[model samples]
Target: MTLSSKLSAARAGLFRSLGLMFIAGFGATVAFDAWGQIVSPALGFANLSPHGLAKSLLGAYGLPNSDFAGYFVHFYLVGLIGYPLGWLFVFRPVWGRVVRRGGWLLGAAAYGFGLWILAIGGITALAGLPFFLNFTGITWVALVGHVLYGVVLVAVMRAFGGR
Candidate 1:
């Protein structure tokens, strides 16, 4: 192909990949939220408030802590971009290299577990909360939610013909 044509093809591929990532991320986040906010609560588990945590973290840094800011950070930054990018660029690639078999589901679950660690172990501390929320019921709920997020993310990507 000519140089211009090659560049155009590359650009198209990039956009496609990005679109897939966003879709997958959104789906996974929605599942995580549904379980944390709705199903888990109905089952007598603690409800997750990731946005609230986001607000607290922002306020701790003297930034805007409005509901809008929290939702935007939780849904747009982390859900639509951060997690998906991490899956596409980091976890998926690394998992493929490490497993070399039909173990994407397990790899995705492990990724979710890592995300839980990041949130409970890292983010909570940053937000000035007791580390791991003192290992309360919410911590365990969040663990399941994060794992569901990972599984749903990979499933969505796979459905959309992505790795």
Candidate 2:
């Protein structure tokens, strides 16, 4: 294929893959939240919403209902929205690399390092609210959460590839 054709094909792949990922991620988040709302409440932690983290970090700037559910919904939506972006930085270059493998690591690194540490934390800090100080304690949980997100993305992508 010509350069233009190759670029167009790649763009198509990115769009198609991103759309699939977004739908899958959104469904997963909704299901997880459903379980939390229905089952977790019986266990404990009644205080929850779909915009928790966003509320925690940007709560002052926005409305209320600050908790995990809130954060999960917003987080999944925004994260999936950036799906195609992974292509440019992670999966774009592969022309007979001697290694012949490792896109998952590249993509996961972009997710964990770029989005998790830099984007998530940076956005929270940039929100410029006093509540951010509270995050210091549970920051590790949040970090691990993003790492898990990276793993989820890779796994989901592999599964989707099979279909």
Candidate 3:
């Protein structure tokens, strides 16, 4: 492919990847939430859900905890941040490798792990929240949830001819 053709292909692939990202993000969030609500508490977790996180942050600001706003923020971040970042970091890098020998499932799972690090290690710290607490189930949930997200995202992107 010519330089222009390559660029066009990449752009098209990016849009397709973003669409998949949107779907995967929401799916992951829903799974995470359900796990937090139904499973985490039984496993001795408290306020570990995304809604709980948002509620905590809102409490810090003396704002009321709104589930609507929390879900909106969750979905918005998936589309606005997750899509572009996934394309730039995950999709492009995975495809850019000349060898491209790894399975898409592995690549996507690795990408999701990276995202979990960024979210838990970076975002949580930046937000002044404890990265890890006494509870470990939440940690496992986040890690596995993100991995599943990557699996689904890669499956969708590959189906759509991304990379």
Predicted structure with the largest lDDT when compared to the true one = 1
Task: For model 2, state the Cα shift of residue 102 in Å.
Answer: 4.9
TM-score of every candidate: 0.96, 0.53, 0.65
Residue-wise lDDT of candidate 1 within 110-145, one digit each (tens)?
Answer: 999999999889999999999999999999999999
Task: List, residue by residue over 41-123, the lDDT tens digit for candidate 2.
Answer: 55553423325556654564675644654565365545555532453344334311434565565555445544455534566
* Candidate 1, superposed: residue stretches over 4 Å from native: none
lDDT of 1 at 30: 97
lDDT of each: 0.94, 0.52, 0.62
Which 10 consecutive positions of candidate 1 have the poorest summed lDDT? 95-104
As a TM-score, model 1 comes out at 0.96
Better of 1 and 2 by lDDT: 1
How does candidate 2 score on lDDT? 0.52
Say which prediction, candidate 2 or candidate 3, comes out ahead on lDDT: 3
Q: Compared to the true structure, candidate 3 yields what TM-score?
A: 0.65
Predicted structure 3: lDDT: 0.62
